[model samples]
Target: MAILSETPELPKAAVSPQALVGAASPLWAYFGGAAATGLAWWWMTRFTPQNLEAMFETAAVAPLKAVEVAEDAVVEEIAAPLQAAAELVPAVTSGTIEAAETVEPVMGGEAAPLGPVAAELIREEEAVQAAATPVRPRRTPPVPPSSDT
Candidate 1:
């Protein structure tokens, strides 16, 4: 087999004037996009703040507060059920059930009453631990190989 020529002939695609105009313009397209984005941002800030704030205040605060409230409500609701279940266990084991059973509430209703000194000591220990331990830096130190242990 023999090679046809040093230079290879390339096939040409048929392009129109509209295509040529479209082709001349990657820069223009990028600039137009940037300009349009700026304009949109300006427009949104100017025209949309009142409506946005009304939505935003409720939108931001409500969900977070709602989530917290929901979590608290769930905990509150589950506690009574759990306490009742715990009380029932004793009844199941022994056939004789007391009419006036004193079931301890499960909600941990009382705030943890840690002494000020104890709380301070715990905080100090945590601070010491935080200070003592430094995270290892990204770059590893080069290790020299040993000939013998």
Candidate 2:
């Protein structure tokens, strides 16, 4: 009676792989796995830019590009005035002589060589242009700020 009451053993159930597989649906396992992957992707995309050094590098380059574009525009503006002035000198001097020749026949119809005054003015204009020519050498781009910690 003691053995029957205290030591009776029940037969253990055996589990086979196929029986275990049939018990649980594969679809639920796949859905849970997919959900976990999606959550991970969302988290990484949300925080990836701050964590990556390349984003800061790209930001740093933007100012340098702006500076380069501004420099080009400044140089162009400065050159335009100088070019106009240079053209005016030739046109004014030559156009006057040509007009004189056509309207009132000049002596022997030989155009006078440019006078010393004209030569001096041309020289002065050229000197001014030489001085105005932008002497700035192409500058190397500034180094990006260090992100190294």
> Could you tell me how far off, in angstroms, the CA of residue 2 lies in candidate 2 after the best superposition?
73
TM-score of each: 0.26, 0.23
Tens digits of per-residue lDDT, candidate 2, 1-149, equal: 77789986877677545665553755678888999999999988887335457878888999999999999999998998998888888545887888877896446867779999999999999999999998988999999999996
Model 1 weakest lDDT span, ten residues long: 91-100
Best by lDDT: 2
Worst 10-residue stretch by lDDT in candidate 2?
16-25
> lDDT, candidate 2, residue 114?
100
For residue 135, model 2's alpha carbon misses the true position, in angstroms, by 64
Q: Against the true structure, candidate 2 has what lDDT? A: 0.84
The total number of steric clashes, by the backbone 3 Å criterion, in model 1 comes to 0
- Please state the error at residue 64 of candidate 2 in Å: 1.1
Per residue, candidate 1 scores C-alpha lDDT tens digits across 60-141 of 8878988998999999999999999888885343433442355555775688889999999999999999999998869977
Q: After superposition, how far is residue 18 of candidate 2 from its true place, in Å?
A: 74
Error of 1 at 106 (Å): 37
